[model samples]
Target: MKADVMPKPQNMFQAYMLLFLISSGQIGVGIFGFQRIVGMHSDHDAWISVIVAGIVSHIVVGLMFWILSKHESADLYGIHQHLFGRWIGNGLSMVMMVYYVMVSVTIVRTYIELIQSWIFPTFPTWVLSMTLLLLAWYGITGGIRLIAGLSTISFFVILFFIGTLYISPIKYASWSHLLPIGETSPWAIMKGTISMGLTISGFESIFYIYPYIKDKSNGAKYAQYSLLFSNIIYLFMMIMGIVYFSKGQLTRSIWASTSMLKIVKFPFLERLEYIASSVWMFVVIPGLMIYIWVLGRGFKRMMGWKQRMMTPIICFVIFIGSLISQDREHIHMLSTFTGRCALFVVFLYPVVLFLFQTLILGIRDQSDKKGAAE
Candidate 1:
């Protein structure tokens, strides 16, 4: 099959929008409760783990860009077909498509769980699941430019939420809570970094969206900047969680970031956490749309399916997946599975693929030269 074609100029977005797309994608449901998971591994030094994960994400994204740069206007699907022949390549691409679908399910279900747990105990999981999926379907159908626009809006919504964090949470933080930070063992910090894979995984979406970037040269630069921005936000939140709650409390607080917002009070508006939880849909939907869009797009490329036909099918699958996994134990299981898969898919696979591609190209080049000489 021909390599993936370049998107028309009207469909392309600025390289700068990548900053929003990548940043918003990384800062979804994972941020709300990631502190507890990271804290369980690294204790107060969880901030270090966050930094390490962020650096590794930067490296993985660099590898992805390098791979794409070696090919002309190709996305991940095209790269796969080029690296592995069509049969093996389609198999791997299908695996990635399934993974993206799981990611969408995880994001939507986790958000629904948060809403039901925090705001309305009796709310129907299917209702919220269908609602979010419908919103995602609308955005996905609008196309990449609309998806990018949603991400841009999500970025500022994140900023607004971040600004709210300082208002109340900062006042309660205990500076000495983070004392002797490096006391956590290196092994523990590494474990924490591994646990961080899921939270930081969305940066890999760059692989699929790279072909749609208007300025190819600036893609890597802006993508790196986006990762840096996400890292700063995560590090800040990690430190806040460390200081705002006691060690025991921090480990137990599932939604530590949202929990921190509970103290923000306005005379006219009480229960700010409830408001934050509701408004967070704006942040979550864009990331969800991006994943679903990529999943649909991958199928379209690999099987010659229409994205419009695949979009609803993908969303319906995710919606059913969300409804079936409503309880905490099942949600935790799904999240853990996704996280483990992400460690390989988002981090390890790119480096391995890049090296394998380089070796293959080297052997091919040598064979071409030998044949020419003969």
Candidate 2:
């Protein structure tokens, strides 16, 4: 998004806060749970799946940024309407809105479930969900620019806490288990990459914020770097998860990365994972906030509503949706289902949009040639 949408950054770094903010959103609660899930399908070579996910994510993110740069000023809702025409575009916009709202709900359910299983076993999810909804609503009301600015600090804190992964917990890594990488079929990696696709849906930021880009010409480059950077982070996390947890350990475990930290001891504390995770709340917060904001943006443009009223309205809806998950099992089912659904928008939509737009571009070019000849 253009830097002008919320605060006009005085410097280029401030402007690039959008990049960091978007990246931060991409690095949310999912990272905690992903290792266990990836290990299920890919084994210790699951690290390879993350690398695969990074490549696919980079291509999809690149496509999204390219689409945004082409238009220069319009958001995804606008692009949908432009590409599909009024009725079809508006319908697609509605689907996209539902798609985004589903994402916010997924984040809420994921966060609350994480808290319940790992930390606050007695906490009521409704209260937890409502609390997160309200906090995110506050950020949204403040505007995307604030979220953009806050992302830098949030990411730094997230990184600071993540430093624990480099410690003795890593000694748990068994090299022999991972010796035969790609021992699995090509189809296994491809199928498992689908789930990893769910883990990397943060690229939606470009669609929502294209209007705020400071220089449209460099939008693609900035987005490209963001993809590369996120890939590195994800791959590292995956490798750590595989090395520390082992394939058998990861296959059966939930929140394997965070759980692995439970064994980590410090001179000062024993339950280091709890301490590390206490701060991760901030990391996931921005992600939930930005997604809610993105959904609201799509709705506002589609329906001509004001941001002020729309932000709280969507937060309420997401909070209610999150309350529906009765237990960890239900939340797990929802995550699996939604992860499958998001595959379409995250990986397939860009390809579809690119084909649609490419045809449009070709026709326009042909028209120009004919006009020149005439």
Candidate 3:
């Protein structure tokens, strides 16, 4: 199969922006309530699980870069075609596209849930879903360079949200809550790491976005840096959740990160979480745009559908998916299902693909050498 055409110089972005793209992509709505799920298994040692998950992500990302580096100007869709052939590869690519769509839907619905729960109790879900989908559609139409710029801005918005957490949440922390650490068994910590699958899964965007990066050699370096940055933010939030809330409280509080923001009071404003929830749209939109762009690009590469024409169609599908679950139970079910799928797609698949590719190349090389000798 022919390799993908290299993006134009003006369309490509600097290697450094990988830091922002991967970081913003990984730190979405998951951060708000991941503490409860993770803490349920490992308790105070949940932070250790966060570290383990981060290390594992770094290794998986290394595998992804190795795979992409083997073929010039080939993204994940092209790699699939080369490995599995036209029929099977397109099928696999479609699976990935579907997963990306599901992830986008989860982010939109979950964020809208937060908005309705915290700030506006009577807010209609479809209205917010359409509004966010339109914003994401606009960003997708602008192209990858535009999405990269939004990711950069989202990085700073994340910083602002974290900065607000430190001000009030840390004050109420009970350091003793973390006493007698490492009491959790190894098995439970591993379970907690598995539970963290969804929150840390977004860095895999590197697979599709790799071909568009201007500096190929340094791409891995910047991707690792982005993972480290996100891990630090997650670690901080996990530790704070452990200290700020009692064991029962931590497990019960669904939106621990935003719940932590409830205490930040100023002379000017009364409810800080209300403001944080609203500003979180800035962070959510960029992530949604990145995933939708990947979906549209995947269809274009594998099925020859134009990204410009397919983008709005993809957003409409996401909108429909988002509207499927309105209650907390159904939304939780969607997030949980997505998290489990992410474990295989984002983490395990890369290692499997890398090993298979290496083996196939080795066999081909040996055959070529034997033929030349004969």
Pairs clashing in candidate 3? none
Task: Give the per-residue Cα lDDT of candidate 2 at 129.
Answer: 87
Native-to-model Cα distance after best TM-score fit, residue 259 in candidate 3, in Å: 0.8
lDDT of 1 by residue, 1-374 (tens): 66666788999999999999999989898999999999999998999999999899988999899988887788889888887889998898988888888888899989999998999999999988999999889889889999999999999999888976556888998999888979999999999999999999898888889889988899999999999988999999999999999989988887998889888888998888898889989889989998998998888888889999999999999998888886899999999999999998889989998999899878889999999999
lDDT of 3 by residue, 82-171 (tens): 877899888988888888988999999999999999988999999999999999999888889999999999999999779765678788
lDDT of 3: 0.91
TM per prediction:
0.98, 0.92, 0.98
Residue 246 of model 1 has an lDDT of 92
* Best-to-worst ranking by lDDT: 3, 1, 2
Highest lDDT against the true fold, candidate: 3
C-alpha lDDT of all candidate models, in order = 0.90, 0.77, 0.91
Please give the lDDT score at residue 10 for candidate 2: 40
The TM-score of predicted model 1 comes to 0.98
User: Where does model 2 exceed 4 Å of error?
Assistant: 1-15, 365-374
> Can you write out model 2's per-residue Cα lDDT over 248-315, one digit (the tens) per residue?
77777778778878877878888877766667778888888888888777666777688788889998
